[model samples]
Target chain A: MTVMTTAPDKRDNAPILSVRDLKVHFPIPGKGLFAKDRPLKAVDGVDFDLYPGETLGVVGESGCGKSTLGRAILQLIAPSGGQVAWLGKNIVGIPHRDMQPLRRDLQIIFQDPLASLNPRMTIGEIIAEPLVTHKPELGKDEIKTRVKRMMARVGLLPQMINRYPHEFSGGQCQRIGIARAMILEPKLIVCDEPVSALDVSIQAQIVNLLQELQREFDLSLIFISHDLSIVRHICHRIMVLYLGNVMELADRDSIYANPKHPYTKALISAVPIPDPEIERNKERIVLTGDLPSPLSPPSGCVFRTRCPFAQEKCATDVPTIDRVSETQEVACHFHNSI
Target chain B: MMNKSEKTALLQSASAAKEIEGRSLWRDARIRLFRNKAAVGSMIILGIITLLAIIAPLLSPYAYDQIDWGYIQEGPNWENGHIFGTDGNGRDLFIRVLYGARVSLAVGLLATAVSLIIGVTYGAIAGYFGGKIDSIMMRFVDVLYSLPFMFFVIMLMVVFGRNIFLIFVALGAVEWLTMARIVRGQTLSLRRREFIEAAHATGVSNFKIIFRHVIPNVLGPVIVYMTLTIPQVILTESFLSFLGLGVQEPLTSWGVLISEGAKVIEASTWMLIYPAVFLALTLFCFNFIGDGLRDALDPKDR
Candidate 1:
């Protein structure tokens, strides 16, 4: 079942998931009978590779397609175009019957924990669903034992198995979600802002728990979030997105310490440093324009309208991603000059 | 020895806490429903009425249609054992009223069940696979809605020759439009919930997701609507029977009984009084139970 595609020569081993030029366009209904149909480009031509056991952070503003990218890779939302190669097999256009088995190894945890779980289902049933779907051969007793063990591992009391989602706090609900996602021991789990809805204290606990479980199961994560600080804590490699396009992609240290793209630099500058003296002295690049609508994004470069150093050439010529360093790539025409 | 006792006490407290935590949504709703006095009273009355309906024929010594020539138009008395008295044709009014209840209650329940199956399936399909399909299905419902309801029933009767089973089917078919609308609305919202997305992510089949996730979440409103719908169906049946289109002769329903009784009101008021009281009481009981369920199952209240 291996898909024949060009494998990057730099990596020693094949990546767990490799997505190239992925696009998810939602067609908007025409306003009039003669009006032309327009498509909302939610995730337009995004490319990335996730190595085994590595956490790839997707950081972007709301509607910037970070969430769409995560969903597109998992095939939750079908991509309008391009390829999603999972374990060297293209899964984007696979039949649902064929995709079912793949789901056991690919799972996702949502942002709003309470909303992500079925209120009618007991906590035990919620966590056991994936196992029941994927491993139907296991006996009832075996399933119950696995559910209890997973519950305990995720910091939920096994005694709360019969309780409903509404009965628990947000953090506990997230733990239940994590337990459900991890019950299958997935190779790659897309954490779509899994901690954004939790309290500040609970956020750390969930992040720490995710890190612990990743080590225990050797899980690769596509952690999508708008919170730069939280993404910085858990992600190894970070990708910055603007208007459904990747503005920058690099290792976490390079992204934060020396951002190559102007948009990435602006995003990093917005994260306030804890030290008062350094924070006051640091320059903040606050671009003056609102984000261009995806319906008709700025001609050529999608981020040109918001880029601080936009030029006449920027409006006409889309800058393709170029390697700025051994581990960093930027998609700005004037990256070296600016 | 004191330390051992303390440990035992702690274990007991922990088990007690677990007991408190184990109360499920259904159990909570049950507790709330039990606490509603009006609902409980309505339930009791409903139970008694149902019991009477089941045993009504056996309880009466006289046949529902038996012409007691000796006691024609007699009032309530012990002489002939006619408690509720004899009707215009000397038939046992009491037995006829009880038998009539069987027809009314059966129609109410069976019609609701039929509607439930049709509405839930139609709505789930329309809502789960939305966009063009949803628009087309709902538009059909809306078209059906525009047709005069009574005329539709009459057309079915005229076309099918007024069978009792057809009455159930007609009433059920007409009533389900509203049920479908309610369920479709609920399904529309439930489909968007993250749980449904999570279910989709798990690669569960669409059929399984609709039945297993969407239906259960929408059941609260559907159950309430069903209770309310039963009374409406019963009333519609009564209205049709009054117009001589429902429950053909020899097999009488409450509606038939009331219709026949209304003609001789001046000569014998008891004929109309008895059946009307029973019908009103049954309708009230259903409404009370519906209200109770609405309050009990409201998630916001919990």
Candidate 2:
């Protein structure tokens, strides 16, 4: 009953969250008064619609703004530009005081689980904090009962409530983080590499627990991670990002079976196959140059610097996202030929 | 019925386990502090000194300010019951030194408490908020920092009139600047920490985050600074008293005793020796305690 439901059949219903052309450009500090200010475009012009209960995996390499995009979506880091609409209401540029009531439905889980939990606070206090903030009317006994129950659901012993975060192991700490996020019963949770810090075996457990919770709560998730294999396992739709731009957006099966973008193709191929025979025979496309500096990105296609099939035209013309199929979108000028 | 009994038994055992106090970071630091011989020894010595200061009036027969012209400039002689002997004015140095301890210790503790309150709140807010608010707040700190230490204290004394409480307010106001700077620097690094970010994401108000999250995390350094600040505040008070801007004549401080002792040191050296020894011992104890706290509270060392 807790198994992940991968169906994208909920298109008939309205999207719970809509992010249109979201941009988070961080301005660099200039040396002198006359010096031109350079802005690092962390999440450049990202657009996505998340239906209820759908998980959108944002895949990228290190420093590709996957985490920034996730944070921007939840308004943890304010968006420099664009609209983040929650139930057709624009949440961008809203004062934090106003954002408080809306935050009950929007939550986040961090990458480093242990780092996310405060060292001074006990597990009970940490989990109960959200409840204490949002639901002031709740009795102390009621909050404790809810926290203890949430702790149990997240696989942490309720008896360990008085223990500090440092007393718990990494996996248990992550459970505490999950318990805190879940206590609010948030409608949309931006899971920013939730299981990346855990061991492979532990990652499966955390991922499984997330799926179970999602099903139970009917929650939508924006799962951000660099690991494609884990993203493929849980995410219903995957969005491939490179240097703060989406290279491809496709359904999970379509992304794995037939990735259209050159960057996505390289990324998918890099994932190690389980079987030795297939792994040895599979062709690998290893791009040569390092990730271009986002400070001064390439003029046209951001990927053209490290692209395998780059041409003169690739440098001169920026490629807009083209709908190649009903389930897939590729951002490459020569995607059809290639 | 069996399940109910088992659940109760489990809860009872858990409660019993909880009786052994949880080993928090503060508790861990305390254990480490006791393990350091110098710190624990200093603590005992400081405790003795404080006790003596508190009960000085009860212990001594002669009043702190009583003049005995019969035994003027007398050396350490128990025959007259002045163990530390008498000064030029024939005032018993023993009673004077104990009374001095009272003033010095009071100034040290009260002034440090004042600084801690102002510095921690000001620094934590500046660091947590950042941006334009941080710039403006820190600039104000910088402006305050530029004032000459002696000049500022002298001005404050002139304006507020000379009193022990005024001295406390003056020293605290001056010293809290450095503390605020230290706290602000600490808070800057802590600002980027994931827990602070987590708190923000959890919809905690900025004010609440500063108090509950930021202030507690910065306390290790703040506490260590506080221990060190006590000694500094004591010395500053002594310097002020030496200049005759501090405590008035009837109520003498270590500085007053030392200043009077310096004037007559050629004739009677114990007058200088006794008060000097007490002041030095107290400063040393505070320094050692501060060192111990730094070692204990430092997470890197752990």
Candidate 3:
């Protein structure tokens, strides 16, 4: 059911990051008895790009490999295949040791604020660690000064520098994370569901802070989340992913105004709009089916098994993403029909 | 990207707000531990025990190996200045016990250090790399662990033949297995941490990541393990000495002293009581310190 994306492509804005055919396969211990080699293809051949100073939101189900893609782009997980080019330089397949200089341009904000940080490191040390590794030439005072500056910008008190991560709330911890990431003045940052683990009210504050910080730093971001509304608020461009494949990619407002893929439709319809009048009027497209295991995903288009528009041809031919219009791209075959 | 003016403003504001700094879990835990009376008391007790262990040879009154023909098993003879009495051959018990403390503490400390070095390094490397290497190393540990270390030590004693140096080597060998497992488990968890990934992304060397970043992260448990490990080695050395396998005859430890006394418990009970009491006291002190350190170093509690 591809009759969704109608917007035009806006690629002329110099793209800052491009990830082509990225795949992250986790070799989970083999099957029963015979022990067949069936790897959990977490992120299989996903393609996307980020232009300068814009947020590219990746929304998906829990096991959709969205987080894996973010890590692979940073070469943290070492993608099994594909190209991750940062400013025309291929970063994949290089030793992590050699990738150090490029690190300043790419950073990440993790989902679990507390787990991601070293509980042993102080707030100042946490922010300073990146600078120490990337900008070792900087003197100790300069490092400390930069770290303090970032902390203050994030709204943390100077006295809190001596405190451990356990002392901070979920929101404060995320601010620390943003401080750490932006301290290096990175050109691109992968935000792996940074606000998912925080309180609801804290989420907006973090999002607003991120937007402001993104603008202040002129940073391009890969905002990974399952929260549709939150994604809609921050991301200029949004990609809907399923299992390990991209289902739809379009401008944020266009997708919200007219979600194309059945999966995207389900995600938007499930947002539980607060206004009773609007909520009652909008029908929820509740698709009853568990997400298929990545280890043995169904044949052809990953969404065919659940799609109401699934046809005989859908099972035999894989749907490759095609630009339907200047503003939208959809993978499903029937793009012309509504 | 932010325009130059806005970027400068952000930087200026950031400079004004630069107040927060990161502190590690270790430092935090230590602060908590300092506040715990029982933990602090244990620390003092263990410290005293360590000091005594190191200074035993310097403080002993009688000569360790000299035999007195006139004072065989003599109890506190003023002429010989033997405060703890004498052994069957009139070798000064007090002097022998002091020298024994030197030998026992040396073996305990050195052996534990050896194992910790071998274990932490091996475990961190294997677990961090985590492939065929991890599988091989872990299975090796599993095989070694399943075998009774005490029996293995006895077999080693018989195989390599018994020697004083062999005792440390054997104990170190067995203890390495334990330390390796502990460090490996720590490395496994620490390797998955975001800071570790952050370190990798920032171009930090693998060696630094393992030793500085990852190992230090899991050091709380490693340290707790080490404290308890020291006592374990001490007890093992004592058991070996009791079985006629440690410190030889001329060189004695609290273990040897206790064994020497155990031989004649039916008669003069002072010999067994002194050494046994000393060994028990040392072990208890270590245990107290271990509990204290665990509480002091707990990240969550901090």
Candidate 4:
């Protein structure tokens, strides 16, 4: 994959969000009284730092804990273990009441646009909800003015505010979701596959809208998606996930240009190039097996079961994330060789 | 100071705003309800019945309990001015049936209102916060559900003494169980919907989320169940009256009239027919209205 250049890398300031060893495990009940219940490790020991005004893209196949990680960062889903530090303060385990004020700074955009919006609420009310919660001091007229302005900012007609979400198209509903998330002028916004539900044409539009808003608001965005092509454009850095673990995390150019992990290679190889000549000539690494279930993941390196170069040693030993360069981290034992 | 294009834009948005302003869920449902012929007809009939119930004394010359020994067990006759004729005791049947309407309708509405308040709050809180609290709350509901309804009402009547207000409390206390169950079931499904999750992400309080988000979403089912419950409540009231444990003399209900009517069907058929017709009509109207509301509020239909 050719490198899609982004804005100049700036790491002058402290990180806005830091996630360390974040694990979300759900307990599945046992069959009988004597049987011990097993915990489904959906996200196990993941770590990342999100700088202010940077977009971190998380890429993974279905059920690989991409959405779970995004939700955990925003405290939307409780992480069974680990720390989610927002602006250097650990926000994990904070009661929901205390979490409310923090929510004004941290917001999320969901995958299903229409589902994210309340069907009963008018577009105006949906967008104004965050304002209603956080800015109680703001009068009704002030909130309405802010909502209408936000609506216009997100490319929705201010007049259409009175219309229900059902009346709007998928793209428009997504804009409303964006408007709601952006209403509080949050420092960080989690875009959890915000464009996966839209048409191909609308996907570009929404992605462009997000990029523009990220720049305008100077917002740190966690863009989570399975679509590598779209992620390459929007994300400054990309994290490849397989079976609830990070296979690789690197600067976008380096990850695309020189993908170290076999899992990352297989994922990038799947993205179809727009040019037929390059598409046909490009080498595609097709893995053999499906993603292992998170319930009882492979004991060693989570990706080893599906890794093309899996050895007997790979089954017994977990490959910790090894930093290959200043801008890249790969979690594979033989990343140097293959 | 606005440009021509800006002025046009303002005018256009202003006009466009008007078209969609009143298109709320209730407004749409009302429109759909009116479109349903049966529901509309039922509404008109129910309205007129409620109106007549309110002004029955003013309309009728003979008092509801007035006894004219001269016309005992009389059949319908224009000369005596008893349009619906006289009951076994020579009291006007028309006036009694209308007065009964006041009692029966009030009980149905007020009891349902009571159940609605308790049931919706109980069920929404239980479902929205699921797990231990939900399990315990629902188990409590199960305990209540197991309490034999007749026995409970009888106990209440025995302890508190049978009065019009006690009937409302007894019926409402029991009726809310099913309403809570229906609401809980709906809330269980709705709690998982992305919108509810979105509300949580927005930092809306748990209290606000339950009332603003959960309850409104479950209202479609709650409303349908309520219509069905009213007739059920009315029937229970009649059953209690039949057992001679409800609504003492002087103050009458549809149930009391119906029970009295049942005993003397062979003698004066008007006593039975008048109140029975009114009760059946009211029940049918409620059923038809419920059907209309179910159709109107159904997301599937939309």
Pick the lDDT winner: 2
- Cα lDDT, model 1, residue B11: 47
The CA-based lDDT of model 3 is what? 0.82
- Poorly placed runs, candidate 3 (over 4 Å): A1-11, A32-34, A95-98, B1-24, B31-46, B52-61, B77-81, B139-163, B299-302
* Positional deviation of residue A217's Cα in model 2 after best superposition, in angstroms: 1.1
Residue pairs that clash (backbone atoms under 3 angstroms), model 4: none
DockQ for model 3 equals 0.44
Better of 1 and 4 by lDDT: 1
Candidate 4 yields a Cα-based lDDT of 0.87
Residue by residue across B59-138, what tens digits does model 3's lDDT show? 66656898988788877665658778888888878777767778887888899999988988999898899989999989
| Candidate 1 local lDDT, B95-187, one digit each (tens) | 988989999999999999999999999998999999999999999999989999888888898888979999889988988889999999999
What is the C-alpha lDDT profile of model 2 across B78-174, one tens digit per residue?
A: 9889999988888888999999999999999999999999999998888878899999999999998899988987888888888788998888888
Candidate 2 CA-lDDT value: 0.89
Kindly state the number of residue pairs that clash in model 2. Answer: 0
| Superposed model 1: Cα runs more than 4 Å off | A1-10, B1-21, B299-302
Error of 2 at A184 (Å): 1.0
Better of 2 and 4 by DockQ: 4
> What is the lDDT of every predicted structure here?
0.88, 0.89, 0.82, 0.87
Residues A45-107, candidate 3: write the lDDT tens digits. 988878888889999998999988888998888899999888877888987556877888888
Candidate 2 lDDT by residue in tens digits, A205-300: 789889889989998999999888888889999999999999999999898999899999999999999999999999999988888888888999
Q: Which digits, one per residue and each the tens of the lDDT, describe model 4 over residues B1-302?
A: 45547855775566456435627777788888899999999999999999999999899889988997888878888877888888778888888889999988999999999999999999988888899999999999999999998899889988988788999999999988888888888899999888888888889988898888888778887998899888888878878887888788877888888899899999778888888999999999999999999999884764
Ranking by lDDT: 2, 1, 4, 3
